[model samples]
Target: MIQGDTYYFAVHLSKYYPFSKRVDRNYYKVEISNKSEPSYKFYTIKELSENNKYIEAVSIPPKKEGYFLEREEKHRNEY
Candidate 1:
């Protein structure tokens, strides 16, 4: 799994700021990037707001790769 370098994201509801009224929540998908040398980029799967919330990087264990191969073999016999 590319040496387990895959990135996962976690989202949370943001606290209300003093100036902005908490009428309704607006959601947007933001594209973030490290605009420098050795750059990287990623997009948010969930909608985000400008002021309210932020994204965090979370790690999850990768599943067994061998399971995929076994599933594929079973499907072939059904045809």
Candidate 2:
């Protein structure tokens, strides 16, 4: 939660679209900083091939904080 902290998150498409076999999970790298007005920003790093046909999905819960908390809560609820 502190500024200048970077967090990594994975978006699993399987949970949202169980029936869809084409959707692949996406990974997002986020950094916490005060450079912007929101105090945070999200960056999409190219992990997979550019030609890969995958739908990027992020299931972060609604919150006043950044996606970091939402990602943490998602894992907590799963177990």
Full-model lDDT for every candidate? 0.36, 0.37
lDDT for model 2 comes to 0.37
Over 1-79, each residue of candidate 1 has an lDDT whose tens digit, in order, gives: 1225444342222334222223346522223222211122243333332324332212323266578678888898787
How badly does each model clash, as a count of residue pairs? Answer: 0, 0
Model 1 lowest lDDT segment of ten: 32-41
> Which is the leading candidate under TM-score?
1
* lDDT for position 57 in model 2: 33
Clashing pairs in 2: none
The number of the candidate with the highest lDDT is 2
